[model samples]
Target chain A: MSFLFARDGHLLELGIDGLLAEELSAAERAELDQHLSTCAACQARVDEARALMAQPLPALASHTAETEEIKPPDLEQEWSAANNNRLWVATGVLLAVAAALLVVVLPSGSQPEAFTARGGELSLEVYRQTAGASQLLLDGDGAAPGDTLGFRVRLSEELHFALVGADSNDAVYAIWPPQGGSAAMGPMQAPEQLAAAIQLDATPGIERILAVACDAPFQLSDEQVLSISEAGDAPQVQEGCAQELVRLDKARP
Target chain B: MPPTLDIDQLYRRYGPLVLRRIRGFFRDPAEAEDVLQEVFVRVMESSDSFRGAARPSTWLYSVTTRHCLNRLRDAKRRRELLDEHGTAMGWGASAESAQQPAQLLIKQVWRELDPELLEMAVYYEVDGMSHGQIAELTGVSRRTVGNRLAQLAERAKDIGGGAR
Candidate 1:
């Protein structure tokens, strides 16, 4: 009962290695302690393995730009759609230029530079889990690997805010409007927290996540939409709309 | 300028881990990178559903795993498309992401694993969960966790050798 032996009646080296990695906890750690107390061989194994592990792991190769920047087929479709829309706009521009005088229409009080039209405000914050409750991240900071991070969005108007994230590897993701549904809801009266949280793992990279709030639901074609209700699905990004949301950054440990 | 998505910070935090996880799951690291971008796009698409109720890792874990699996399912189509188009015109995948015959052989081996075993392997190997953690997540015993990982490794090796 005291010795941490393999089924073969010898010390389990894997268990010892796991113990050295601090992988064992609770009952396993207690059992490991008992085994270490009496087993000199196991102790030596742990010491040797621990020393070897202390040496730095091999440095990873820097990924190529193409590898980092490439995206899956669906996003390419999304990007192509956005590109097609740009072509249409270009055609419109040609027709407009053909006209002698063009009157631009602007709604009253609508700022030319703002993301929102109807006096809407948008902001994004990252919440990190520490001790017990979640703490807000500041200064475009990041979280440690394995830490739980959640995004909270504050919107002045009840609008749809699409959330998107890009990783250090240059992969762009729709962190909010996963695939099928419309944009996420913003608070009507005040700034509020999002319900889902992100768990940072040992991926050893940073993430930038943002919420783009719009006055109306951002449009995505059915063909463009990936089924978010299913796992591993992505929604198409309407490039123009996605570019218009609020943004934030998280540093990873 | 698009004010919504923060370009610089977005790449900083989630980039490495997402890329790493995607790479771990797929045969080719380049394809993993491509999937990595799609995963982020999916995150945006599901903005409405994600309200910070669950841990973001949990959601991302399944998303990454499932997305890789689904893409693998379409590997045949991808191969045919690649052959027809000769790696041009927005096929989205780079030349490096193209599926090799050996990779396809491995994928066949991967498909033969029990669904539960495959899921557990992904959680442990890619998500970096321990046997105990995987057991808790999957409602299985620690011994079963150990066994499944060994099976996954052995099968992978077996297929890798067979492909050559």
Candidate 2:
């Protein structure tokens, strides 16, 4: 059958891959060489492939057996610990006020139910980078101010979502949609990290990172996020939204 | 026991080829990079399977192809692919004539095609693999590969005709 896109005499992509991998037999290589001498398009692809091959590989976080294992996070214990912390208690009044504001601002019937954290429905993987080495951060792990935090998530369903970070002072910051908008994400069977990483500021308290997924497109405006953070509540979304939260303790070096 | 596989060595050697192939399917470099990382992570996770393969590059090539195809099956990703290559759908237009016709055909009908046929289309048209080569890779007979490619060509023609 004649292929709609195939050039009659041009070399194939497999040939290019094999040529670069040095897997081609001498006869195949000679034929490709002769073809490359005449076909600029194929040669251009060869050159492009060669250039891509020469690029240095970036340092990837180690997924050693021990660190790669997924452990069920103890959210109840962590929440209790956060409440016991002096910083959390100091912000109690602000939280109470923010909670009241949230109640007033959110539409009564539209509020999404709290998403039960299931094993695979939604989960967050945190990677901490310090001094050029990247390590997976477990729940309640202490991260220093200068350390860079990268995030990845595993999801069972597609949803429009945003990652927001709330510090101990009840301040909220956008983490994923760096531009402060909701982005639609496909379901990730594996943990896929976000492209950008954020450096931890010198805030000595627990910073909660929440992954908020909704059925429809949703946005967490600065004011809404601040109110939610201050209220120590999850971001309010239309019905059908689910949330996953991970905590990082920010401590002095 | 399978031989131990060194992920760093594999990445240094095969990462580029994998990325190059992935770039064919994705227009966004960042998205391609994300897939590249995922591909390597898969390699790392299934090191024993990788180590047991006849050729590391070939193994990686197959893995990358399967991963990209599976990702394309996702509705969100399919939308992204269509958006990126939507203009290519104008196969008869002189303006889009510069684009690869096989790629244009893919952009037009990939969503409608099942995974097996889509995989065959990619192998036969995008990669320019011969029936025998595809047969070798997929473990199907060359005659079956030829029949599948013919079916793919017919489907593309139908889609192209409808689009026009």
Scored by lDDT, the top model is 2
lDDT of 2 by residue, A118-197 (tens): 23356665556333223455444555654556555556678777877666555566666665567777565344546555
Off by over 4 Å in 2: A1-7, A62-253, B88-99, B161-164
Question: Judged by lDDT against the true structure, how good is candidate 2?
Answer: 0.56
Listed per model in order, the count of residue pairs whose N, CA or C atoms clash below 3 Å is: 56, 0
Candidate 1 structure quality by residue, lDDT tens digits, B39-80: 554454344333441333434445555545434333243344
Judged by DockQ, which candidate is best? Answer: 2
Error of 1 at A58 (Å): 25
Error of 1 at A70 (Å): 22
Judged by DockQ cut-offs, is candidate 1 incorrect, acceptable, medium or high?
incorrect
What C-alpha lDDT values do all the predictions have?
0.41, 0.56
Tens-digit per-residue lDDT, A1-253, candidate 1:
1213443333443354345434455897887788678767657756755554454322222222213322212222122121100000000111110121111111011001001111126655444544323333432233454445544445654566665544333344444544423464544222233434444333323343445555567754333332221222334354434322221222211
